[model samples]
Target: MAKINWKPGNMLYPLPAVLVSCGNNKDNYNIITIAWTGTICTNPPMTYISVRPNRYSYNIIKETKEFVINLTCENLVKAVDYCGVKSGKDINKFSEMNLTIEKATKIDAPLIAESPVNIECIVKDIVKLGSHDMFIAEVVAVNADDQYIDKNNKFHLDKSNPICYSHGTYFSLGKKLGTFGYSVAKKPKKKYRKK
Candidate 1:
């Protein structure tokens, strides 16, 4: 076995690649691909997304105090990367990328119609970090595509082929091993037959 030492940096990989939509209306909407997003709390449901201060969508969301976190799938990989690299100041992302802006149930920012799941959030606070600003938001509503729901009323989000950001690449979600709590859960014993 060999060992090596490395400088500290952001080595956390396999993060949720989400398209955050923010603007006053559909006419001025913009989508910014973000990997620095995650759930923060459970009560009242909160999440956080880190954005650079100079990004186009940053000001829009800061002023509006609302945005939609649309989960990206393998099908949206192109648009997702495009949105991240390009600035809204130069182009109309929704129209240029052929994305639809559906009305949000509880926010000004519209949801991405192509996304399988749209999470509406209202920014509760903003923390200024060195490189990026973190927008801590409270989840207002969640809209899921009806097609992903099974006949049993269970939401099959895993079947959507979700995409994730790792290092600098995008990847489709891998196979599932077991449900939560399966590791320590006791297995039922089988009845023995007379030999």
Candidate 2:
């Protein structure tokens, strides 16, 4: 195998493309597509999203200290990409994209009604990094679409056909392979009964 080296940069590919909604009310509500976001902790439940300081929604999120991460599905790719490119300062994103705003439980930030999952987070801290600033937040509430939840309440997000960003393109999740601990766990034993 051969490998080529390039300049130091963000080469981490295949990241979840999510719509991050912010602002205190309908007046300033905005959505920004973020690929630089993920879970950072489990105990306290933390996640982060990186955005440039000049972005229209940056100050809204900074001042409010809260936002909602709307997980994007295949159907939301157009809106997701549009939100990424368009500036909230010029147009109303929710209206332009036809995305509905639903009230969140823990945060005042509105949730995307059509999103598969809405994760409400409170900004715990902010880290200043070159190009973008990282907003470290504690997940306060999570809302999953009722359609993705089963009768037993198990969330089947895979069925939603979630989309991810790779390089410069969007891709859908593929078929099932194995779940957590499936390789290490032993199969259940069958019991024999006398006829």
Candidate 3:
């Protein structure tokens, strides 16, 4: 395979597309779709979402210091795309996108009730990095919808039909979130690579 260096840019493929809801109250509540987000630490449950300084929700999150990361699925893809492009200042995202806001258990920010899982975060620090400022937050609470509680989905959490973004397009990874030891389990006697 021949590989050529194009340009210095964000070449990381397949990132979780999340709807981050922010604001202190119902009047100021807003949602912004973000792909530049993920878990950074495990001990205290930390995560970060990078947002453009000019975004509508940027100041809301900055002042409130709280937000909810709503994991997106196939059904929410249209809304995700719309939310990312449309400014919350011009329109009510929750009403326009038809998303219900639920009160977070441990945080002041409201969560998307339709989402499979909502991670409530409290902003620990803010690092201004070029065009986007990274909101480094600590996960205070996580709410998983009761619909996901099933013995049948013990191994695969694919029922939600999760969606991810690569470059400019959103893609769905079908089934099997992880199956690490499948090969080893099948051929135990064969010596394999570094574990």
Candidate 4:
């Protein structure tokens, strides 16, 4: 196959579409849909979300220095898109979207009750990039819906049918290819039975 060179740009697609909740009080509570977010560290549990400086929730999160990243699923696609387009400054997103606000344990920001997982974070640093500012935060707490948890304590995140953003459109995750490290994993040997 022949290859063609293209201009340098953010080609990374299929990113998690999350609803980031911010504000310290009920009046200021707001939600901003974000696709530019991901886990940065595991040892201390860190994550980052990038938002334009002009975004309504940008200053809310900056001032409070905390936010909750609510994982989006198929059921939340409409609300996610609505929150992304509408400015929180002009309207109350939670009420308009018909989403419930569950108080977070370790942070002032409220969690989206409809989300399967809510990750509470406290801003550690702010990196000002060109178009957007990146908020680097430490994960203070994580709340998972009890319904998604099995008796074995395993979280069925896939069952939630999480959605992702690719290029300029949204898509649902496809079928499971395999579990981690399945290629090099050892296979059980065949046992001989008594003849």
TM-score for all models, in order of appearance: 0.96, 0.94, 0.90, 0.97
Model 4: clashing residue pairs?
A: none
What lDDT tens digits, residue by residue, belong to model 1 across residues 141-161? Answer: 999999999999899988888
lDDT of each: 0.94, 0.95, 0.91, 0.96
The order by descending TM-score is 4, 1, 2, 3
Strongest candidate by lDDT: 4
Largest TM-score belongs to which candidate?
A: 4
TM-score of 2: 0.94
**What local lDDT does model 3 show for residue 17?**
94
RMSD of candidates 1 onward, in order: 1.3, 1.9, 5.2, 0.9
- CA lDDT of 20 in candidate 4? 97
Clashing pairs in 2: none
Q: How accurate is candidate 1 locally (lDDT)?
A: 0.94
Clashes in model 3: which pairs?
A: none
Which tens-of-lDDT digit does each residue in 52-136 have in candidate 2?
A: 9999999999999999999999999999999999999999999999999899998899999999999999999999998999999
